[model samples]
Target: MADYSEASPPPKNRQIVLLLSFFVGLTIALFLSVDLMVGVLIGWIPPGVERQLGALIVPAFEQQAAPSSAQDTLNQLLDRLKPHLSAEQQQRDYKVLYVPDETVNALAIPGDRIILYRGLIEQAESENELMMVLGHELGHFAHRDHLRQLGRGLLMQITISSLFGDISGIQSIALSAAQTIGNSRFSQNQEYKADEMGVTLLQKIYGQVAGATDFFARLSEKKDLPIDFLTTHPNPGKRVQRLEKLIQQNGWTVGDRSPVAESLKMP
Candidate 1:
């Protein structure tokens, strides 16, 4: 009883300690929130690191079967389109890779890489439709949307890895989840921007925006939208409407359709 005063702290000191603890907790919470937002909304990974990560990540997800003949055809198409790209676009070293899959999907990744599945090529009703798809993917690359997507994915993995000390067994799971989230999360505004750029590129290369919306219009006619990582594009009907509006505004006329390349036959 005689030593109680010496053992007990003053009320002011207790209040100060409480205030400090509150601030420290608040700071930690704020940091975590910022980290989440950066991973989800502000993909800002540096280019070199993004390429390195892409080199490691993309191949793992691609089908191993080779598409030598289809690839040659794709390259020929790419070469034909190259003359129309601006110096800025051409200088970026854009590449289109063919994946031997029948998923009817295309993916634009970091390092200016675009992967087109054989199914998508076969699904196109005309050469103009296929070019529209290529142009749309190129638009994504030009805007660095591919980098942004890859960055966001890596950020999520890094965060999870840091918390768990490693992501050995979980890397595939994390990647799969990231791909799902990233594919579906591209905003409507971003979709519009890519569409606008695609139409512009089509007009530049082919002299008209004909069949720019052909793919979307076909999808819109489906009984149900294809549910897959490849279907990240905006609502099919809405995308067609937007493209039609843009074409009308620019006084662009639809051009004659060209048959799909014979060599582009699906495997």
Candidate 2:
């Protein structure tokens, strides 16, 4: 038998080539996936603003006068919702803030702060609809999305820090290349978790849940609402599908249909 124990190792050149190819392929695939998903999430965004995340936070979407009456309605909804929602479950420490913009959007910040845009408030067809939508935002927060964003360090720094020190420009170039894929690199399991939790929140307040479903149905029918690759909410049609299914399966009755929880609205 051959003296296998004494056999020499693979040649250095071959090892180097193998290693280089493996790393190169891995890096390409990893970043490609990341860029793709972020791109899709922000798809409805303007092309220029969509390109760089830093650009999206800017001078401000037009500021508006939030009517006192609307604020009262919102408060009524949150009061009921607070007991039902898991404050600690979503890794969020949330306090609601009103945004000045008219476009229906809500965002959760790192410190448990959620900004409810005026646009989102006014557009909601009913109090239930707004609660359902708010539930999703809360789901994102409890899931610790803010923490994950921080973990990414700098979307710009990943290249320079991961590669050679001189590779600063490579960050932008790399991000641009990755944007084409538009597939969120995070495991699909997370999305499922959000969906399930959101449903639970909706179940507790199905009237609000029904409102959310109705709102999505309305949004799906609209020609003007920007449905883009980068937006995270998915399509209103898909949302309606999921929301309706939840209702049908549980035969859940509507909860307080009065309006946005009174305690949640700003004074």
Scored by TM-score, the top model is 1
TM-score per candidate, in order? 0.70, 0.54
Per-residue lDDT of candidate 1, residues 154-262 (tens digit): 5666445545555463355345543653354455776788788878878887788787988888888998766763256668888899999999999988988888877
Candidate 1, residue 219: the lDDT equals 87
Tens digits of per-residue lDDT for model 2, 51-70? 23322221121133343555
The prediction achieving the highest lDDT against the true structure is 1
The alpha-carbon deviation from the true structure for residue 52 of candidate 1, after best TM-score superposition, in angstroms, is 1.9
State the weakest 10-residue window (summed lDDT) of model 1: 41-50
